[model samples]
Target: MNINGLEKTKTFSFDRSHSAKVLFKRPDKFREIEDLSKHNRTLINTGSNLSYSPLGFYKDSISVKLKKFNRIIDFNLKKKEITVESGITLSQLLNFTLLYDLWIPQLPGYPFITIGGAIASDAHGKSCALHGTIKNSIKEMTIFHIKNGWLSLSEKENKEIYNLTIGGIGLTGTIVNVTLKLEEFKNKNFITYKTKVNSVNECISEITKKSKEKDSFVYSWNMAENLKSLGKGFVFQNKINDDNVENFKFIPEEKKNKFLPFLPIWNKLTLKTANWIFYYLNNSSNHFQEDDFTSVIFPFYGKEAYFKFFGKKGFYESQLLISENTIEDFFDEFKFIYKKFNPTISLFSVKNMRGTQEFLRFEGNKICVTFDFINNKKNILFMSELDKICVKLKIIPSIIKDSRLSKKIVEQCYPEYSRFRDLINNYDKKRIYKSEISQRLEI
Candidate 1:
């Protein structure tokens, strides 16, 4: 399992870069290894290595890759179910589903992410208000257990493992394949409505009410002075309808590929000003764009290597999922922190969630605050300040986004932290399937 182009590897200098000792890639040939339960090895759970956590945080075992295990095992059209290998990407799955007029309703922003990673993270999409997160669409999954070998799980068989595997972060075992529930669609026609709001509170109320009234997708933007630029943007609500007569082929092909080449490093100075203008337009616009699935999400996707956009300095995002009961106060306090730290935040969005049962599953009526900042001394200091604020407010930073927060902070934020750790310990006591974040949190 040699990594590709190590000597020529494009170096990504994030806070955790110093910790990544091994960057292993999977072999193209299929080889079955012996029992891996004995060692305290931790498998790297990165689908595309887009994570920002430190390397040594998890078990210092050899990093394994499932990239070569690509194939669609089966699909039941009548039942609207598809089973695929773990290496298959979201983009590949979407293209396949489109051909058959079937789709996985909840799609993460990045198309390159693997189904297994999405499941482990329990990724949520813009349409989560209507369809919930990715965990909701899981009908069944097959994981390669160390002692038990390949075990199939669902709501029925091995229900405990199934529940854990849904958002277990690949700790229970290696997710070799997964079976997903599909949404049927004869025509990919959707109605989109965009409207700007004055304040974060106003946007939240409108989004919550509108999202509940219809099976729709919603997202909000902020444009204000300093870092407290709350709710100065628009709310986009989209719903699939059967009456649209436009042909899907009528849409124009996307000209630029690979995220418009990530704006030159020298242009980093202009990002803030440009983003502010974009935020203003988003908040001011009341018109909606008729677009396809790809245009609707991928263009603004967080993938395409966000670190490269930050010039010599990379970027770090600390996302938190606050409880619904404390959302108002959370936002109020977040605004205060934004003003206090005065960090250069690139993009900020808010969305409402229903709930989930995954061990560390981020759920409930709350808003996801994602802070993007350039990797620098100032940015690092800002992160530290944010950590102090989160601690004081009892805010639980997302595991997948920000691993900078200490284990104590995570324990306070997640009510199920002990339960999640206990579940992992009971199953993989040796801690073979671990990551830098897991190690830091001592999961």
Candidate 2:
């Protein structure tokens, strides 16, 4: 079968400088996992390459595209559970679930991301303090290994493999299907309030206070215009609007043409101007508004136009999860670095995170902060310095966001790295499932 001409092609957003030819495959063409198990070729499972990390791209290896397996295999309305193929996109899942008045409590900012990709990256959302990551909602999953045809994993069955694969970056095997528990809400509207804050400390305080509410989603954006108003930004708190029955009728489709196809080159001046404008817009008026689920949950959808700001080099995001005790110190150092380097940082966001799991998990109650900067040598060096500080403070950098992280940095950041690697080696002794990130990080 012709797999859409994917053979001998390159994965999307592959590093321009890296000349790696990837051989692609579609599982639907094969009747069973045993078909590929005998081969020694390195096989890397891939979904939509929505991750900023190079988890899906492989150099001169077989890339299995799971997109063709997209389907809703089963649904239990009473249990509010659905089993879906890994390749189903978030948008598709949401649409299907909304028809039954069900919702996935946690979702990333982007809707195009595939379910398998979300679970592998352990993607978090604005309400992570309450719902945790996507892994929390998954009841069970079916993963296919070269040696093991199909293994069933969950909190109770094959729990070790389950833990490893949740944030395992697809090293364990190719996730085939997932059974997820869905949440039910009376309405799909959110009463959103945007409050301007003067500093990162205030932002954290506001987020903490808002997160105390039973069902509130809170996040903050830090302005990067200038040192005079550094860390000044807006905090958004959104609660489910109980009174909006009409909004619950259906999830609104994403707005079209809301963002330009391409943004102009980003520079200090342009970014500062954009930051000022955004701050003014948020602070001017109408701090309170009612928004549909799409607007509240996937706020950044249909905003691919921002990619143009990074120019031809693209961008890199450094996301850190700092414990409550060390958050202030982390921000202090972050601000200092921001002032010293003055890189063209386009965005900064903050959210609350709680709880912990074993393997590649963010331990303790912490706050997640992310910074996006145009990729360049100077900014790369700046990020390296920041990583060193993170290592000292015991801050955990998100492997899903930072593609440039070295193997040493990952080892230092994740204390369980050794054990995680051992699990991978034992599971796939031949190293059949490998990616650029897996090899680069020595996973």
Candidate 3:
């Protein structure tokens, strides 16, 4: 259906967890965005249609997609910077940047996430300990609001809005264009060193030590379903080298995933079998890859079926960014919750993350652990218990990962939650721009 030459579509979150019919517009020109800003009180942007959580699509609300806004405005070789429109995908950006042996330091695992969406979500990568979130690469941006019009923001210019807009979840305004600070791609290679860990504590300890190595990524694939060896897993430390490696071709985006099941396919026994096979398969201690750039980016590009297996019931991802001091205590409660609920945890992983702990941003110097649970009453209730732990331990649960996260938990977790809300209210009093995240969190 078409309304006002704009498409009307039933938009579902990437995880199929939330759905809403929206008046969708793919506007290219800054004028169109500004004009929409003037008229629509309820507006938000959608990108790649790929966020796990709903990105502000209420009934009849206008959703602007920046597909046509993709363009490379400027590329300075010496400065290692590129100015691009918000619609440009990270894959596209890297294709262009890698031609000149330059790329964005903060690379998202998904290939098709737009520059705008990355900024809005403040997406973090596996190597956040080294480079932090996408906010670190953003040198400047031009955002449009009804009142502010087209305002250029940066650290030194409009610093407050810049900070807010980074993880603001698109409430601040429509981010039209962004100037990303790029890094020169030297001959850097990483060797994946896998070690068998006894428990979650061992994993965290190894990750902490591994993170100290410069330009390294650390993560653990835990067998959380096993009570006897809970959190027993392999710690993968990708340590870097300056040696040159043969370039591999970029993995193009796969066609629409056809395996979206009608019923959920993940269960404890099934997951346990799969996790066990994967765990011991890498008996070797080290993996040598040919090219860092090609292999490191877009880990999810070819693995769409993993998401589809959740089917209509969808899934819930609770990614907690908890401080080092509180993690030990938090895990005590975590184990109790796991034992009590015995929730169907399909997948579990942990990453060593280090970034700013600021208003509404999930990034922090903490142990970032994520769990994928089948969407059911038991799992849902289990997640609620985790939320309680988050509040008690001052952990920041990722708002972008879960659609059902409560505003009260958000308020309790983030110290500057009220401040972020107040800033948005003051910046755009009518709050013309809002997303699913903002409305849910009452931001």
Candidate 4:
């Protein structure tokens, strides 16, 4: 089953942040994964390797890429359910399910990420405030281990493993495939309203109010270009509708972000220009415009060039999930830091999240802020200070986003951190499944 595999001396992670010398494996079937685990060093099962964090591989360890496992196992239209290989990407699943007038309800901004990645990260989607994460749609998971061989995990079967596997950061085992209880979807168009706000508080207010609605997705872009207009940005309120409206004829094919190493485009000048242009463009747009599901779900599909803007040095994305009570202090402190650092943020957005927090999943009635900045001393220092502030506010920094997050910060942020560590340690005594994230966080 291990038809093809090659060792690589180094690999830059999908996030373009961390790179490491790794032992690599491309296994076609479950048996190969088991066999490799028996012989290799600590291993991590990799999907598309699209995660911002180095969730797929560790330095000098076995990284098993699971592309061949991509396949559709079964579909039940009557129940609006599907079973698919964990290696399958969200784009692949969406393309297939859309034809049948069905779709997965919860989908992250980037659709190139694999089903396994979504389940592993418990990633929140556009409907994050509504459904929480992909876990709510997942009915069952089939995982393989050196000792367990194959285990079907669900609420009714292998419940403990089921709980741990969701947002376990792939430290549990190799996720073979999954059965998702999907949704019947037909509203392909959304009436989107982009409103310009004068302050971060107003933008956050818009997102919070719109989040409670069933047929819409809401998010805010916080501008960090100026001290006076630091938190002033636009809030997008997209409301799904069955009404006929103009949209892109087809979803754009996912493509690799062409690296612009020689000519970086994310410096202070470009950041300011881009912000000025983007702010006006969206701000000047019609009060209401129709967009397709593709536009709403995969915001980065055709705009992957945004990533290329980071150049060879890459970028850092830090997101924290904190309660509304913390946002006032968080916003004030963040603005103060922005004024002090004056780092050019390539992208900054905030959204509303509501769900139960467990394990390491990012959830809760929280306002989540994401800041993407080019990798540099100033930006790194800014993020480092931000991390300290997060710890001070007891805000939960996204464990899967920030590559440099320390175990101490994680221990402080997540009250159940010890429980997660102990559970997985007891489950996998040898730690057969591992990644840079797991090792870095001392999981």
Predictions: Cα RMSD each: 4.0, 2.6, 2.0, 2.3
| lDDT by residue (tens digit), candidate 2, 239-277 | 988888774443334445554534447777888887888
Q: Cα miss at 34, model 3 (Å)?
A: 2.5
Better of 2 and 4 by TM-score: 4
TM-score: which is higher, 2 or 3? 3
In candidate 2, what residue range of length 10 has the lowest lDDT sum?
10-19
Pairs that collide, model 1 = 233-283
Q: Candidate 4: where is the Cα deviation over 4 Å?
A: 1-4, 245-262
Taken over the whole model, the C-alpha lDDT of each candidate is 0.66, 0.80, 0.81, 0.82
> In model 1, how large is the Cα lDDT of residue 292?
66
Error of 2 at 235 (Å): 0.2
lDDT of 3 by residue, 194-275 (tens): 7789888898898888888876787788888856677888888766555656563554644445555555666777778877
Q: Total backbone clashes of model 1?
A: 1
Poorest 10 consecutive residues by lDDT, candidate 1: 4-13
Clashes of 2: 0
Give me the runs in candidate 2 sitting further than 4 Å from their true place. 1-6, 14-19, 29-34, 38-40, 247-264, 362-364
TM-score of 3: 0.95
Q: Candidate 3: which stretches are off by over 4 Å?
A: 37-41, 240-244, 251-263, 284-292
Best by lDDT: 4
The sequence of per-residue lDDT tens digits that candidate 4 reaches over residues 317-345 is 99889788889999788878888888878
Q: If the candidates were sorted by their lDDT against the true structure, best first, what order would they fall in? A: 4, 3, 2, 1
